[model samples]
Target: MTDLAGRTALVTGGGSGLGAAIATALHAAGADVVVVGRDEAKLDAVAARLGRRARALTCDVSDPASVEELRSRLADTAVSILVNNAGVPGPVAALTDISVEDWDAVFDVNVRGTFLLCRAFLPAMIERGAGDVINVASVSGKRPLAHRTPYCASKMAVIGLTSTLAFEVGPAGVSVNTLSPGPVEGPRMARNFRLEAERSGGSVAEAEAAFVSRAALGRMVTEEEVGRAVVAMLDMPGLCGADVDLSAGMIA
Candidate 1:
């Protein structure tokens, strides 16, 4: 197991789903964790479940004022690990049918939020000459998903940002990488399947089957699998500038 004892980790969107799983895993590895999200109840639930090693903070990542407020709140805390996991699925539609508002909303959370958090926390890591940064991207970022232009584009931006930041901070002994999971089995994936079904005039089951067919494993990845990947990333050394694929060969 990766020994993260005495370290403090920050995971955004840690209220539920993959975020909560990652936070729990980090806490299990002996790290004090801060779970940040916009939903107070969800965040509180996660924090409570994580016991004394975890705490919750509410922040709207897309808003500068809110991010600044979060930075102020963490002024005295040292964050050794940062996970930029907050994201939206965005509208499933043809490019021509997608609205500017929908596209911007996806980018605001997936891309801008990651950028803002990195901006807020990276300097401290650099100053300490040690840290890990994981940006939760998607296989859609590497490959393309039809009718998911906004989400795919935003995640692609995340991969690009992660790669660039890795190079920029590697000299300071901080590792930066992207974790790209494919069609994770969860409410988010179910919702995406539903949206695709509506867009294609197909049944939700067919949409889900189509997604599963894209994976060599013929199934969506589990949340615990993602949590294990996060822990592996934290454990590995000299793993900078890598886009770690937890996509069940979907990218291949």
Candidate 2:
């Protein structure tokens, strides 16, 4: 068991779902956690539940100004763990029909935000010779989805980013890894399923079931499952730069 006692961690998108799960895990491991998200109320609620060790901050990862503000605020704090989990589902459009604006917007959060956050935090970690960065990518990063051109492209870019950063920072005691989860059962997934159901003339239940059936595990991933994996990564020593696929073997 790895102990993060007295360590500081910053988790983006920690207002709910997988982000909350990772924050909780970090707290349980004895780390002081800072949760950031666009929703102040949601961030507050999660931080409150996470106890005194957790603090909440608000920022939109897609906005350069917001990210700059976040960097300023966190400058004085020694953050050793960085989880880049904030992301958009991306505007659904066929590759041939996608707009430049739509593609840029998605890339802004998934790629540019990841880039900025890493750039902002790495100096401190490098100086101290310790840190871990987890980028919450998706199976779509490795495999293409029918109508998710922007998201897929952005995530694929993330895979490359994770690998390259891991190599560059590994010698300095900073570990960077990417996690690509299959479909997870959460409010986000439910909303997506609902939309697909309506658009495809299928019931919501049917749509959800179809998603599960296509997965190698024949089930939707649980928040707890993802939480534990992140926790494990935090615990592992000398581990740097790996694409951990949590797709339940569904990559095929």
Candidate achieving the largest TM-score: 1
11: Cα error in model 1, Å: 0.4
Q: Which ten residues in a row have the lowest lDDT in candidate 2?
A: 89-98
- What TM-score goes with each of the models? 0.98, 0.94
lDDT per residue (tens digit) for residues 198-220 in model 1: 87899999999988998898888
Q: lDDT of each prediction vs. the true structure?
A: 0.93, 0.87
On a 0 to 1 TM-score scale, where does candidate 1 land against the true structure? Answer: 0.98
TM-score (C-alpha, index-matched) for candidate 2: 0.94
lDDT of 2 by residue, 112-199 (tens): 8899889888989999999899999998887757777899889989989999999899999899999888888788888878877776
Question: What local lDDT score does residue 238 receive in model 1, on the 0 to 100 scale?
Answer: 78
Question: What is the alpha-carbon lDDT of model 2 when measured against the actual structure?
Answer: 0.87
Top-lDDT candidate index: 1
Off by over 4 Å in 2: none
| Clashes by residue pair, model 1 | none
